[model samples]
Target: MNDRSNARKEQRKKRYQRQMARQQKGSKRYQRTRLNVARIQRYRANCIKNMAHQVSHHLVADSTTMVVALEDLSLKNMTASAKGTVDQPGKQVRQKAGLNRSILQSGWGQLRQYLLYKTFQRGKLLVFVPPHNTSQECSRCGTIDKASRRHQSGFACTACGFTDNADRNAARVIARHAAYGLIRNKQPGQELSTVTLRPIPY
Candidate 1:
């Protein structure tokens, strides 16, 4: 799907460039190409927004979990330009630009906003915990060493030899933070409190 989208975008770019070079700015051909590109962009935006709505609604209404916990993320800061001033330019400008584009295209903010409203409307408790070190901390032994998450998809705790998928571990850490209000120095199941909330109809 992404490949097809990229192909269409590239084709539109070439067509638009060609039309701009040959046609006058306000000519029919130029206006047509501009409108075509705008339509494509609007379609993509609607697709992303619809997907975000579906995912968020499903998470709140379809899932059995009453407590929804999400990491408090600053998408704007995450996608901000890494390029500094001309005199003191930043490193990895191209890589950061691509990363920022990818992040924006992922619709993280849209999903979060949908979840916020849906969760509240459904009477489900939604909590946003600090995102700091949720990925680096070991979910098993509570170790905060960065070496535990040496790989993107893999996590192995250096302190206790605990191994798990990186994303799953981070999720567990987030759940633990939500459940116990602490991320470290706690025994398994200690200080953890779970209160079951009756499902409320929307």
Candidate 2:
């Protein structure tokens, strides 16, 4: 849905840019085209917010779900500019910029906010586990090996050869951490170590 919206926005943006280019800088037509571009941006933001609300509502409305776990993400750090100082330019600047844009567009922060309120209203617990090594750790064997994540989508543990989708494996790791903390009656904000997570049957 976001991809389609982005495509449409791009098409309209190009058309508006062309129209603005043909018009005088301070002309009414140029100002109107500029407003159109702003409107497109606003529409995209509204769509993202709506999607976040829908997703958060669905998760909170699940009867079987008692706790909703999410990564304790730091968007400011994750989306920090990768363009280093002129003396020492950053590597993969373009790639990092694109990643930052995608992260912002995905509305992760917005989704988290929506989930926070919805879960509270629904009387469901919302927990955030540590974000470190969740993807590299094996869900079944509890091994943490960078080599286990051979690709973006696949995870194959080197220690026990446990295999699964990378994202799913990370989710299981997060779930285990949350479950372990709750079972031990750990206080909120107490650290949960990925290394201490127990292996369970897949």
Candidate 3:
């Protein structure tokens, strides 16, 4: 969808520029081109929203799922632009901008919002555990090391020599954390205003 959107955006940009140069600012042709661009953007937004709804509904409605655990991610902070002020210009501005666009395009915030309300309405527990070291930690041996996930999709534990998909390992870790009641108390309607977790028995 992003690729298609970018292609369409480029094509529309050229046409819009040409129309503005030749036709008047408030001319019919210029207005028409602007409307077309807005329509395409709206369509993309609807598609992303629908996709998030479907995925969130599935997780909440699944009979086998009593608790759903996810990494506590701040989408806004994760996708912030790296363009600094003129006094101190930022580096990798182009790459950061591209990454920010991709993150926003993926609708992570929308998905989380859907999951939040749906899970609450369905009477299911939704927990967000700390996301740090989830991908690097080995699910089998509980070892934490950066080398465990050397590839994007692969994971291999250096301690136990266990191999699995990186995403799957992270999911397992999240589930285990939830099972152990390792989650911050931040959900709505909760009386506690502080972070709470079960103490691990040594």
Top model number, TM-score: 2
**What's the ranking of the predictions by TM-score, best on top?**
2, 1, 3
C-alpha lDDT of residue 127 in model 2: 79
Off by over 4 Å in 2: 14-24, 185-202
Task: Please give the TM-score that candidate 3 achieves against the real structure.
Answer: 0.73
TM-score of each: 0.76, 0.81, 0.73
Quick one: ranking by lDDT, best first? 2, 1, 3
* Residue-wise C-alpha lDDT for candidate 3, range 1-202, written one tens digit per residue: 4677667775776676676678777878878877876776787788779878887887777766766776777876665546656886678777778767766776778877888898799876678777788889888878999999898789999889999988788888767776555334346665542322221110
Better model by TM-score: candidate 1 vs candidate 2: 2
Model 1 ranges off by over 4 Å: 1-23, 182-202
Per-residue alpha-carbon lDDT of model 2 for 122-182, expressed as tens digits?
8778878888998899989899999999897899999999898887888899888878767
- Stretches off by above 4 angstroms in model 3 are 1-24, 81-96, 182-202
Tell me the whole-model lDDT of each prediction, alpha carbons only. Answer: 0.74, 0.80, 0.72
TM-score head-to-head 2 vs 3, winner: 2
In the predicted model 2, the residue pairs found to clash are none
